[model samples]
Target chain A: MTARIGIVGAGLIGRAWAIVFARAGMTVALYDVDVTALDKAREAIRQSLVDLKQAGLIEDVEAPLALIQTESDLRRAMADVEYIQECGPENIAAKRGIYAELEAVVDSDTVLASSTSGIAASRFTDQLSHPERCLVAHPVNPPYLIPLVEVVPTPSTSETAVNHTMRLMALAQQAPIMVRKEIQGFILNRLQGALLNEALRLFRDGYVSAEDLDKTVKHGLGLRWSFMGPFETIDLNAPSGVVDYGQRYGPLYRDVDRQRGDDDPWDSVTLAALDKERRERLPSQGLADQQAWRDRRLMALMAHQRTVTPS
Target chain B: MTARIGIVGAGLIGRAWAIVFARAGMTVALYDVDVTALDKAREAIRQSLVDLKQAGLIEDVEAPLALIQTESDLRRAMADVEYIQECGPENIAAKRGIYAELEAVVDSDTVLASSTSGIAASRFTDQLSHPERCLVAHPVNPPYLIPLVEVVPTPSTSETAVNHTMRLMALAQQAPIMVRKEIQGFILNRLQGALLNEALRLFRDGYVSAEDLDKTVKHGLGLRWSFMGPFETIDLNAPSGVVDYGQRYGPLYRDVDRQRGDDDPWDSVTLAALDKERRERLPSQGLADQQAWRDRRLMALMAHQRTVTPS
Candidate 1:
């Protein structure tokens, strides 16, 4: 029998999740409270599928499109699914209400996963009867092109649920990393937040311009990082390995961290200036067009990634 | 006449710089006080050229190889060169002595640039007779593959020198970003240190494993970063643009930064643990092989980058 997957929201992420499951040959029931959102989601999903097909990421868009069924009724979407991915709003109250409704309608055997970027599964699932089956599977934006899904399990989450989610994600051709404990911002966002903090600080201090800082990354660090992680990068950097690398440059990084001190670069004043600088480069009117460009660039990169064999 | 370039200290960075200049059809005179280091650099350059040829980054290895001439004498290497890329050991005193010697040997028209990763140009060039002509043109390691060059000028450095160096780097097909002011760790290392610090904290606190953290980067954040930078990323991420993104997520990042507090994650204990975790995955004996693999992956990525047209 074909596996059934339930997506509990039909927003951007929900629609992307539908493509993911459908591309993996699973029957996806994408549900939403708003009829207009469901309609928009269907159109967006179709456009994305067409983009994916053009990138050679999917063999036939029609096949995947045929597999997904959009429904406005929550119970109808929840019925007969082995797993449910809750893609509701990031608000805790909204998540709580949705999960409660999902639990009341779905079978006890059905695993519940929330697509929260920072909120822990425990926050919403702790009051539920079957909290053991709930976990957080935070994904990068546009999960189809970017394959990383952070599988975070709360203390109430069962080992079986975690294992099942990991297997399912791999089956869907996504890279799943286990976050052993619930931490604020999860893994991906925390790393991004760290870098963003420093970047903001640098720009605020007038040390470097916004454009130059971006150049340093896209043309420098981001190149190696595209293929290898930081640990692997440092491991291969020094003569011996990670230990040698630590001995050589660890102190320098330590000094820099200490020097960073307690300056909060996320202050509104700094952010406003940053926004001003960014606007100077790309006005607000051009954001949608630039976003489309970014998406196309991501698709091209993903397509290229498929051709290269990583050592 | 083809422009001549001098590469002081024929080590890894120096040899890579030789490739950068030579590949651009410049006559590169790679100089080192140690004869053995020069010979080794020659062989390494030849091997790297062959790799570049195989990657289709260069049309012919022999053409670039024939352009690079290794020399044991500094005076001979400095003669008739339009610019000098000093890749000597990262010691202040050594740099001071080398610059003093270089200032005496080179013509007033020649631009003297250093490949010092962190040191500001003023640190060593202040005492030189021609400090105005001296600046830092720091390149990412293996410059031929990763093409970012941070052109940082000291307060004493002249605008002419900075412009000349910028033009030269661009001509070499490198992405050059100007550092408006002298700062610790420049731009790249500071950003890297921030991320590494956060990664260490998460690992030390048992929130995530070393391998998973890396996966979050390589598979998640790194994908978007390869094409678009953090600023541009956030700009496109929100529907409206940078201001919209800041308004929506700025508080969250601020909260995360504030929550981070002043607890230093770069202590010895954390680093040792990080080293242990890394060695377990990539044993010490396999470092050399893995380094080679990293280079090949970088080559493949660069080769792939050439085929894609970024929007």
Candidate 2:
């Protein structure tokens, strides 16, 4: 039997979720507070699927399109669904209110997941009638191409909710990693923040240019990261792999972190300096075009990377 | 005048450096401690360039090969070169001995850069008669394709050395980031280690499977990373970008750091479990074949991605 997925919020993310579930042969019910967002979302889904098909990443879009049922009625959308993916506003108050309503309407067997970026489940779900089913299921933008979904569950979240969400993610073909315990920025955001902070620091210090800094990842470190996790990378990097790599350079990383920990590096000077360099590379007027370029490039790389090692 | 590059250490990395410089229209003179290693290095260079040419990542290979010179005399290789990239074994004793030899031969204007992965310049360069010309120019395993070279300069090193090396790297078509001060693991390794340690922790806590953990990156986080550094990603991730993302998740990352501090989850039990899963997905006997497949997949994806946003 096909699993039914109820997505509340017919924005791009919600529609992407719909496409994801529908592509994986699951029934998707997409609902939104406003019908206008729903209409735009529907159009976006069609355009996105066409693009995916052209990229040879999707097939049977017609069926998934047919499986999508759009409705403004929240209760109607929630009925009989095994999983409810809440893509409502990232507002804590909004989430709080929605959880209370969702708890009353959502079946006990159903898993209720939020698309919130960083709000703790324990805080939002605490007031819910069925709080155990609530947690964060943050996906990177354009979920159709980028599959990273950070799954963060609170102590109040039931094991069953987590399992149900995980299975749903699996069936939807989304790659999800549990946050284990709630913390700031989740994993991706934290790691990204740390890197950005350092890169910003370097830029601020006039150690490297913005273009060089960006290329440093795109052409350099990114090549391995696209294929191997950081661990597997170090594991295979040295003659003896990880241990040898650690013995030789662990102290350096430790020191970098230590200096990084210090260095009162966070200041307006750094951000503005970075902003100027970024604007120079991509002015405000051109940022949008550059972003589109980024997306298309990502698609191309994904297609290529899927076929070979990055080197 | 053509930029002359001297590679003193005809090991795999050294030879690869020669190809990188030669392909970029620089005259390359490669020297090795062992004559046999020199011969082996030539064969490796031949095969590697063939692959590069096949990939269309290189041009003028014939000329580059002709420009390639081999010698056991360290002084002769550095005679005409303006920049020297040393890729000797990553041992203090080895570097100390090599530096003394290089110092005696190279003019003060020549920059002596070590390709050592871990040891600081101060560790070995302190003994050099011309230590100002010495610094750590660490590259990821392969510099030709993945162009991230972390340039670390000791306190005693001259700023001119950094500028000269950066200019040479730019000419060589590499993405170089300068560490204002020597730090561990440079940028790439530390970011990698941080991610892997967390991934291990997630697995240890029974949050997810190894395959899923791997997918969480390849299909998820890495897709964005292939183009943008971690910060730029968050900068564009939220409506307001990086700052907004920080406001939302920065505290959480700090909290995670607090809980996860001192937890080296990549310990024995976690390794055993991960190894078990990895073996199941890819048996030990099939490691070689699987690796080949992985390489191919990465190539295809890279090709596709390059044409789009991946490159």
Candidate 3:
């Protein structure tokens, strides 16, 4: 049975979600509050689908594009949809209103998931009668290019909902990881946050330049990171395995941690300095071109990734 | 004029350095204290060069292999070498002893650098007759595959040595980042240590599983990090650039950092748990095979990187 997916906001993420599901042969109903945004979304999604086809990421883009139906009417979009991915505003009151209307319209069995980056589902779903179906299904930006989806559930979210979402994501060719509990920034951002914290400090202290620090990742740590994680990186570092690696380097890490000291790692002065450096390299006006460059690189990487099989 | 490079230790890093310099058209003299290790280094280096050639990373393995000469005597290897990369043991005494010998044999114009992972160059080079020419030229394991070389200089190290080393590294097609001041673990490992520290804590607290955390990177953040750094990622993340990204998410990172608390993030309990998980996924004996797999993936990524122009 082909499942129907509802995207309740025709913004960047909502439209991306539409492509994700549509590409998987699911029927996607994309809705937005503004009629103009919905019209714009249709053209943008069409162009994006073609781009994916050109990149060899998808074959026969018209089939997926045909699967997505853009509608301005919220209730019509929600009706009979087995899953609703809310991509609305991040505000609590705004989400509460959206959820209230969604709860009234969608069936009891419909799984409601928020594409919120950090907001816990419970905060907004607490008042809903069907909170069991509500959870956070956060995808890294530009989900069509990146495949990771963080499925974070609230206390009230049902196992059925979480499992359904996970399975659906997998079917959509997305790699979904469970977040057992809620924490600020979730796993992806937290890890990124940790790295950024140190990077900012390093730049602030004049230990390394912003460009060099960027090189440290692009040309160094990130090469391994693209395919292997931190734990796996060390697991293969030593001959014996992870335990051997930990035994050898744990103390060094501990020593560095202590030396790192407990200070507010993020400060405005450092950010300003970093901003100046970044802007000098990439002027704000050239951001769109740079983003397109990033997208192209991502497509190339994903294409290359498909050719290699990991042991 | 092509520089003649001397490798003091024929270990994993030494052999990898041989490929890096040799492939860049530099004549390499590889030496080790133990004659057996030197022989082993030659075989390993030859095999590695062939692998890189097979992976299409190098055009002709024989050319680079022919450029590398294995020597059992230290002075013979050091004589007339324009640059010496010491891949000695990561212990202070061992490195100091090696540096003392190198100090006597190498010319004053020759730049002496250590491939020590953790030990500071200043610690070993402090008492040398010419401390100005000595610094840390730390490369990621398998420099031919990973091009990042953290060129760290001590307080007494001369600008001439730093610039010379930097130019040589760039000439060797390795991305070299300057570490203005000596710090523990330098920039690469410290940033890695910071990420690993939180990863340990997160796994310990059961916020996410070891595999999931790894997935969070390989499938997500690492994709971008593979080419762009955290600062650049955020710079493009928001329309207005780094300052804009900082303004929007700086508070969130700060909040997460506060919630992170000061208790040491690396605990033994978590390492054990992580080890179990890693060993389960990849058994103790399978590490070497997995490492080869990682190398193949890295080569594929590098090949793909060469196709695109970084904006």
| Root-mean-square deviation (CA) per prediction | 1.5, 3.8, 1.2
TM-score of each candidate?
A: 0.97, 0.85, 0.98
Best by lDDT: 3
DockQ of each: 0.72, 0.36, 0.79
lDDT of 2 at B238: 52
lDDT of 2 by residue, B75-148 (tens): 77789788899998888998888888887888877998999876788999887667888898888766776677
Worst 10 residues of 3 chain B by lDDT: B259-268
> Which runs of model 2 end up more than 4 angstroms from their true locations?
A53-56, A59-64, A126-135, A152-163, A178-185, A197-211, A259-269, A306-311, B54-64, B126-132, B153-164, B180-184, B193-213, B254-302, B309-311
Docking class of 1: medium
Instruction: Give the least accurate 10-residue stretch of model 1 chain A, judged by summed lDDT.
Output: A254-263
Model 3, position B308: C-alpha lDDT score:
79
Q: Is candidate 2 or 3 superior in DockQ? A: 3
lDDT of 2 by residue, A1-311 (tens): 48888998887779888988888888889998798888888888888778777767776567778889998888998888988888888778888887777778877767888887767778778876677777888887787677788888888988888887777776677777777777656666555544555565666666666666676676666766677665555545545444455565555554555555534444556556666666665556665665666677666665654555433
lDDT of 3 at A139: 95
